[model samples]
Every structure is written in structure tokens, then in C-alpha cells.
Target: MPAVIVNIQGPYTERDRKLYAFLVHAVWDELGVKRIHELPVARINKVFEEHHSDTSQGWIWESAKRLAMTSVEWAQVEGEDRLHGIAHLFSYAATHEAARADGVLKFEFPAGLIPVLKEPRRFARLRIHFLIALSGKYAVTLYEILESVANLRNPVLEIELTKLRQWLKVPEDKLDRYVDLKRFVLEPGIRQINMNPEGAGFSAQMEALKSGKAVERIRFVIQKLDTRVALEKQIKPRLEPPVPPPVEPMSAFGILLSTRTYEKAKQAAPDFDIYGLEAEWRDWIKGKPRPNDPDAAFVGFCRKRQRRMEVG
Candidate 1:
């Protein structure tokens, strides 16, 4: 199986991750296996329309730019020997060809990655449709990581805490509290994976094992909806839009605010304009690194603001 690692921040947004999967599916499933390196111009809407109808022509070019700009670690694991290299997601990509007004993208597989795709000796049969269907970066990543081992008879995959963070690309400085880890990463990701019928359609669970009071490892237990169907379903490959995550309330600056944060803000600063304070809080947090629980952070800020008003 091939291993891919990308920095989770910056252009590696949820949309970009799905686009990456879309590109892979286009190459492996649509483009002829013989033409393993070059991808013919394919309509971005054909792949992305169901998910975002308002997807603009500019986005295709911009995404192509990001792909050309960002580098990813590519590795293929064989029994004892390992192959590793770094390259831009695309060796070359052209999405802004004036000759083609249609919103389409064409790209070449990075050279280091071409050999692995040509004839994969050991590979997981990852469906491009299901991968894009899964929501969130963590869910998409977790599904891919878990599917690699799904072939094992009733597998219970367990990893130490540190390794899981590395795989999920959770910044080491962020999501430090185990409760925060569970709330922000583990549960949400698992819910996204288990929520879709068009997806893997298998139930997954995470159990955090503690050493004294500290979380030491996470154990993922995957249960097949139908052992046969879960492992071997050859639905005609088609990308289907997933049920998107619920829209969270937005701050005045268009930043998303969790419901808990909103409610606490209302309580913390009844006489104050909550969204305005949220905007102020967000700005103040810009240069400062923040903890995992953003709701708590915002609440604390509001309390300080209230105190300042009383003292002043």
C-alpha cells in the first residue's frame, strides 16, 4: 500500500483532501491503467458538482496552483525494503488553459509515485467515490488508514497516542488534553465514517486506554455491517455527495462559532455585543497559539472583558 503524508494546515483543507482523492480516482479508475502517469482533462464539476454546486471556475485553477505548490511525502512499503521520496502533489498540472474554457483539470503523477501505481503489488481497494463521500480530513484519512487493514479477519487496530496524532496530522502543540482529543478528533471522525450508507457502511469505535490518568493509546474496533458487503461491494464507481456537517453559527468576521461558545458568550456578556467580542477575541488569538477547546477559550475571553468593564 502507498503511504501519503501532507501538512494538515494551509491549502490542505477538507475540500483539498477530497480533491486529492478525486484526482487519484480519475487516474486509477477513469484513466487507462496503461496511462498511469498522465490524466486527461476531466471536468471538476463532474467530480465535485454534487458536493458544491457553486464551485467556481477560479477554484479549479487555484486548487491546481495549490497542488503544484505544496509538497507531500510519498512512500510505498514492501515487506523489508521501503521506497520514499518527496514531490509536489502533481509533477505538472494545467487547469488554466485559455484554450479550454471549461472548468477542467489535467495533471501528471509525481515520478516517485508513478511506479507504485503502475502495478501495485499490495494495495487496498480504496474506492474514490467512498473516500470523497466521507466528510472531514480526519474521517477521510481514518477511512483510508483503516481500510488498508480491513482485510484482516475481525481486526482490532491499536496505536500509541503519539502515532495517532502523527497520522491525523494534529499539530503536536494542539489538542493536548485527552478530552479535547476525544471531542475534536476521535468522535467526530468516527461519526462521519459510520454515518454514510454510500460510504464504507461499517461501524467503527475508539477506546482510549489510560496509563494512570494519562491517555496512552487508542484502540479502533471496526465492525462490518455485512462482513461480505463491507469487505467486497463492487458498486459501479460514482461520486456521491455526503450529508455535510451541520452549519455552525458564524462570528461577525465569518469565523465559525460552536453552539456551546455562542451560548456561553450570551451568558458571559449579556450587555455586550457577542459577535463583536468574538471578532475581538479571534483577532487577539491570531499571534497566540490556542488550545484545543475553542469554546472554553472564548468564554474565558468574555469573562475578562466583563471584568474589565466592571473595573473600568
Candidate 2:
């Protein structure tokens, strides 16, 4: 009888964590190994491929028939999601007792194994929830992974590589920043948080980053033909007409008087109607109200100015 070992790697995503746990749980039952043995995933992958030679190293697993197993599929226990973390599981055809009798592998785990391997899915979920808690950011890609594998029938021999690829892809913006921070935050000897942004934690941190301003203010607002385009993804504003400035009676009177003066001057002498007249008058008044007799005053002033020009 022969025995196999599984190795789990760190820096694993939520999907990987869940898959690893399910694999170990399912295989532990199949091989009659009651306990999990903690080991390095790189080593397990290397050794497993060396013997089986059927499954690809660190990649797709053909059907269980290929591995001489009864069934092969992603296994879900009560609550779990796929691609939450990365782990490798090995299924030995022989029982641990049988293997131990053969003097190859032990039946028990490297003491305190349940503490490490009991809940891979929980670990993965915690990682994501924590990241969102601290950074006030989320990788849409990771969320999609949790959604992908929450419900599955089998776990030991069947895992989907396609789903794994999709899960591992870190979204563009978060990917760059996440890789840089993983070195400091996730490294050993660093005091770090477990679940991020519990309750309003992420929102509060995000609000703080805004320096007491709305996120909408930072986003671009573009008015285009047909429809307005907001480059930043946010909820669309409510449909309402923009409020126009208040119209004043004085301003209206000044405009009417100016029009009348222009008309009279054009009839008297046909040429360019005074350019900048409205602007100049408006500026002099400083947005003040025009006199009630503005029209009469304009006529009298124009006549006086005309006589003076003729005399000169």
C-alpha cells in the first residue's frame, strides 16, 4: 500500500483556499486518512506528478477514471466557494493504516493539522473580506470566484482549471498595488488584520481618503450628444432640468432700452450698431437695476451727444 501527501501554498487566493480544503477533506475520506498532513504545495505537486505521470503538474486534472478513482469533481461542504485560495491534495489508493503498515507514510497528521486544514474555505473568505475591509477596494475578479464555486457536489478528484485561471487574474488597478503591498502586509512578523473593513470600516476609510468630499466630485462628468457619459462608474444622477439663473426686472429693462436705442440710431444713421454697448453698460452698472426712465434718458443723452459730435 502507498500513501500520498498534499501541500498548500501561501499567498493563495480565496478560490485556491477553498479548493485545497475540499480536496483534502474529500481525499482524506477516500484514502481512509482521518487527519491532514501539512506540507509545501510545490513539493506535493512535484512528488505526485513524479509517480502518477497522468495529471499535469500544477494544472488540469483529467477525469477520476484516469486516476483510478470512483468520482472526480469539486466538493463543497455545507458552505464554501471556489478559488478562494490555492492548495494541492493527493489521493492515495491505499488507506493510511495500510500505508503505515507498509512503512511508507504515517496515519496521523503532523501534530495540530486540523487547526491548519479544517477550514480552507473560511481562510479564503477571510482574506478577501479583510482586504476589502482595510483597502476600501475590491477585486471584482475575486468576488466572481466566490460566486463560482459556492455550490458543488464533488471535491476530491474534479476541479476546474478554467475557473481557477479566471479567479487568479487580479484586476488591473488593484493588481499592481496589491502585489506591492503583499510584501509588507502579508509577510511574516508583520502585525496585520484578519477581516478588513468590518461594518463601515472600508467605507469610513474611503470617506477619509476623500478628505471630506464625495467620490462623485473626483469623477469626470462629460456632456455629450444624445447621452451624458460618466467615465467613472457610478450611479446615474436623477433626471432633472438644471436651474437657470434668476431674471431681474432691472436687467430686463436695460436690455429693452438698449434695443430701442440701437433701433433709433440705426434709423438715423445706418452703420455698425454700437458693439460692446450692452457689455460696457452692464459693467458700469455692476449688475445693478437700471432707472425706470432709462429709455427716455437714453434718447435725451443720445441727442445731446450727437449735437456735441456735430459741433466738434
Candidate 3:
């Protein structure tokens, strides 16, 4: 449900996104506790290592100024209590002599937005590292939307082309054609999302649906590419399913292994490459019939490898 209407009056650039992400990460833990937060500029600079130097107080202040200039029409009518007024994205973005010395940035959101900010449940479950790793507005925005539902069983997201364009903040004067939008924004965004160094935790793609000849909707399909197979597939290609046995140990390749598995795996292998050994074990189990308790089997594989190494 749409709750608020925001009319922006300034450009939302990559730097703006960086500062926004920094603010989100900085204030995440203190949502309901504090209205104002002081962000350490050096720490934020570290997150965006390529951008600002240790003394880049000037750079952060510029971004903060942009945010202050951007205003939102924060109007809410709850029963008889109506809040109707124009407000900036942040209530106050101020700096002092102490801010320069301490290398900090002080800011606060409009009080009316507190209810929205406090409800983390509606926010996407994303890491600040993953978010900042993405460059460009489209790629970052696309990732946030896709990742929100990526954990759902074989998730797919569909939105009107107009709405998608608006969500991506595609300028009205540019990329008017569907082909152009797909070529410039959708494809490149998907590539960057898939290739991000931090890893998006899932893979994604966009599909265009048409209404009689004109494209009208965009469909985004995503899969939860869990770490196990993401690691194992590079080492070995999974083939046809093995005939049903009890199940081999550590055969749960696509699923995340429990800490219990990791502990035992470490104990069995000791100094062995646990992950690589896991891949080798997975490869060895091919076409073999095995026990149902496959989780413990991985430890057994390591122990056997240890014994062989000991003897030789």
C-alpha cells in the first residue's frame, strides 16, 4: 500500500545513493532509539573506498547538501489528525567545527517518517556491503526489488513497464523506447547484479511482456542461488540424480550446511581444505547409493582421507 507521496526537486545521483545507503546502515540498529545519529565520515568512506579520502569531509558535506535540497511532500491524514506539509528528505543535515575534527556527519529524518523507518519488516533484507558494491541507480534499485522476494520459492516479480521505469528513476526525456530501456538499463543492470563482487546472493534476469505489439510489463525472475551449489558447481557439475539410497553424507549440496556440520567437518579434516574436500566428496558420491544421514557422511569422508594421508 502506498502511504506517502514524495515530490523530489533534485538529481539523485550515485553519490546520493552512496550516502543514502550509508545512512541506512548507520542508523539501522538505532531506528526507534534515536532521532538523530552522528555518522563517522571515515567509516563511511571506508565502505566506499574508491570515493572519499580520510579527510573528505567536503565530499560528504556536498552529498548532505543535495539531500537537504531534495524535499518531500510529507502529508498524512490519520482519522482527523492530518499532517500536510513540504519537508526535506532529512530534517536537518548539519555540520560543525567538531564534525570536521571528529570526521562525522550529523543528520535526522522527518519525525513523521519514524513509523515507516521503524518497521524494518517492510524493508528489504539487504547488506550495506552488497548494496554499495552496485554502481548506477538502475542496478542498485533493480537489485533491491529483486532481492526482496528472492528467498521465496522460485520467485518471480512482475510490474508495469511504466511503474518499473518510474521505480528505476529513468528520466522521462531519455530511453523512451522499450528496446532502449532493455538494452541500456535492464540488461546492464542484470549483468552488474550477477557479477557484483560482494555477490547479490541470487541471480536475476528481466523478461518483457507485450500488449498486442507494444511492451507493457516487465517480469523479473530470480532464484535463491544458495552458497553450497554456488561453490560446488564451480568445482563440479551436478548431473542426473543418483538412484535412491538412504542418502549420502553431505549430499545436501544445494542447502546451507548447519554450523554442526561445519564443526564436525573441521574436526574430521583438521587442517584439510574443508570446502574443497566437500566438493571432492560430492564428486566422489556420484552414482553411489548411500545412507540417509548424509550430513554426517561428509565428516566420514574427511576422516577416511585423514587416515589415508596418515598411512601414506
lDDT values, one for every candidate: 0.59, 0.29, 0.64
Model 2, 42: alpha-carbon shift in Å? 19
Residues 1-312, candidate 3: write the lDDT tens digits.
223333344665766765675575456545555788777776566556643323455777777878877764544666777766666667888776654645778888887665553332223245445566576777777776676666455589888888777667788889999999998889988998777522466677788899999999989988654553355456545534445565453323222234467568878867565655665675676446654666777788889978887888
**How far is 65's C-alpha from truth in model 2 (Å)?**
24
Residue by residue across 1-312, what tens digits does model 2's lDDT show?
A: 111112222234433333333234323322223443333334333323433322233331222112223212233323443222222233332233322212222123232233333333322222222222222112322332232222122211222322232233334344344234334322211122212222111111111113344221111111111111221112123212224335342332113333345456434433212222222333334234566665454454445545675777
Q: List pairs with backbone clashes in candidate 3.
A: 246-291, 246-292, 247-291, 248-294, 249-294, 250-294
Supply candidate 1's per-residue lDDT for 256. 32
Model 1: residues with Cα > 4 Å off, grouped in runs: 1-10, 29-42, 74-83, 97-103, 115-124, 127-130, 227-312
* Candidates, ranked, lDDT: 3, 1, 2
RMSD of each: 18.4, 31.7, 13.3
lDDT of 2 at 185: 26
TM-score of each: 0.61, 0.19, 0.62
lDDT of 2 at 28: 37
Q: Determine the backbone clash count of candidate 1.
A: 0
Report lDDT (Cα) of residue 93, candidate 2.
25
